[model samples]
Target: MKNTLKISLKAGEKIYVNGAVIRVDRKISLEFLNDVQFLLQQHVLQPEDARTPLRQLYFIVQVMLMGQAGEGMEKTRQLFRDTLANLLSTFRNERIRAELKHIDTLVGQGKVYEALKAIRALYPIEEQIFNKDSLQEEQVFAKAVGE
Candidate 1:
């Protein structure tokens, strides 16, 4: 048998498990005796917070994991595939691209939490790329104006 997973949640904290939203009335600990998909409240990304490409992709995968009643699951999966393909083509950094492939493998294996963690780890690298691109755009604008 697989080992159990234990989770503790504070009062008012929410957890998404197998497409169900659960809010604790008080501090409580939960033990999952079997395999399950879950996302803690702190890790749940709000729609407004999905401002970048990776964040957007994360949101889609998050939906696939948290969506209730399996509604629109196939569509969400398709979106995940489409978004992942775009991200693979869009990123030039070898590290990000390589990690993305790993994330794809994790997702395919139904390891959503691990895939989310992998995606979260890439945010800093993505931010650096974003800053660099912004700086380049600013420099190009300055040159055009001066010319």
Candidate 2:
């Protein structure tokens, strides 16, 4: 029998594997964690590309999930922690948070279609802001108050 593991990505990407359906909505934020898991698996199976930021974060999340780490693993875990901290510290986007929360609720209530619609609405904005450093911080409060 093939062992199936359901993993979710909270960054708005849901994928089903084997007989398991993994919901990637924001309430759980599983995508970021899964990304870390992928990185760790890559490191153990293929160490050559472990230097990348994404891979590094994966390694750290893996170590933390494993409970204990040894020599080399400890260093890698620390690096991952530092990188994640830095990323989270500078990553302040209220709209994304609100959207993610809404998605999570929709997914939990089995409203997949509505969740998809919500995600679609934010896709363009997400892509634009994802890597850009100079984009104006959107005024989420204004929109919230208006609503």
Candidate 3:
């Protein structure tokens, strides 16, 4: 084992571990003796919330970790790769691009939780980009109307 991971959970909190969904009835702590793939309820992103490009990518990777990979792991991984490639080509933000690459490395190493964290961290930046684009479009429309 590389290192043990300790997790605390409140009553009714759900955790997805190695494709198993576990819900604790009372406050509890779990110490994993070995590395495991697990996701807490709070980190799980709803399908509707995956509205942006990076979020959509996160959702795809989440599927792989959550064991909801409909067809198979291989197929889902392929989808992840394809979606990531598209995002890499679509965004010009240097920071976002660099972080995306780091996320990819995490995913490649089977560090899905770390990758999710990285993706969540980029949400604010993504929002800023979208907001800026919307503002620019509104400005262009205002200028045209004034002409």
How high is the lDDT of residue 142 in model 3? 100
With candidate 3 superimposed using the best TM-score fit, by how many Å does residue 74's alpha carbon deviate from the native? 1.4
Taking the tens digit of each residue's C-alpha lDDT, what string does model 3 give over 1-147? 388899999999999998899999999999999878999999988999989999899999888898765568889899899999999999999999999999999999989989999999999999999999999999999999999
For model 3, what is the alpha-carbon lDDT of residue 59?
90
| Cα lDDT of model 1 by residue, 1-147, tens digit | 899999999999999998889999999999999999999999999999999999998998898788634547888898999999999999999999999999999999999888999999999999999999999999999999999
* TM-score, one value per model: 0.93, 0.30, 0.93
Candidate 1 residues lying further than 4 Å off, grouped into runs, are 68-71
Off by over 4 Å in 2: 1-91, 134-147
- Model 3 weakest lDDT span, ten residues long: 65-74
Q: What's each prediction's clash count? A: 0, 3, 0
RMSD of 1: 1.5
Question: What does candidate 2's lDDT look like per residue over 45-119, in tens digits?
Answer: 134644544344433444443444467656754564466556445446777557656755664464543554564
